[model samples]
Target: MALPTFTQRYEAGDAWLANSCAHPTLVQDVWAADMLAPIPSGEEWLVAEARLATGYPKLVRIRAEQRGPVLADPVMDALWWLVPLGAAEELADVRQLVVQAAGWCLNCPPTGWQVEGRMWITRPDGSGLLTDPAVLAAAFGPGGYRLATEASR
Candidate 1:
């Protein structure tokens, strides 16, 4: 099934945020596109995707930093996928999916794209950090991923 689309407001803001957060070396290499761009020959890229508060999806791409040639660059190891918040049949299912995604991201070698302290769920209304596995499980558990105080902090 096709993943749900988030609202346009969320998309715009996310694009802006992604560009603003880009590493200094990648200032000219950043792009905000609906779909990921093809990696150029001899160039490495990192891709990350997530949904905004308005339920809009956003994708960020960054030029991967390379060292020596064979060494893996942790900052360049990227992943992109979507978990439809509206598609979950139960709270437990949502929690499970999130945990699994976070775990997968977190377990990658240190030379992999770091998600532990950087991943998050953003909305035009609010946002939540997804660094802690326990926090994710608790927030997405019985409460259904929306807590009143989680906005913009």
Candidate 2:
């Protein structure tokens, strides 16, 4: 069987995000992206947010596969990462990290589509893969932005 095309993969990811979050409808082959969608905390995923200053650098340190779903909000000057539920407590000590727990709602862009001045820095892959809290916390340091390659050297 031939591998799935980019559009197919994108649609799969889009479906996954919708089911995981707001379950927005698709019309005219275009996702609903004019407004932000609310993503609830707890159950399946927890959102870990950080200032753009810290978030960008952290991504550099974590492995691509481990980074998971991340949302970049230029207007808010923030980056949001989706991790497994309970990440909030594990990453609590990380100064720049704000791991949102149950009851919070995050305005997010639809997977593979930018909306409301927000875009996915690392869109969800439809595999239910979430960033590990320990890896995220390890990324936080006084050392500043260090590339993944530099970390090993």
How much lDDT does each candidate structure score? Answer: 0.26, 0.76
Model 1: runs farther than 4 Å from truth? 1-24, 32-95, 98-131, 143-153
Question: Which residue pairs show collisions in model 1?
Answer: 6-55, 6-56, 53-122, 53-123, 74-111, 74-112
Candidate 2: lDDT over CA atoms? Answer: 0.76
Off by over 4 Å in 2: 22-33, 143-148
Candidate 2: residue 26 Cα off by (Å): 9.6
Clashing pairs in 2: none
**What tens digits encode model 1's per-residue C-alpha lDDT throughout 6-28?**
55444443443233232422322
TM-score of 1: 0.23
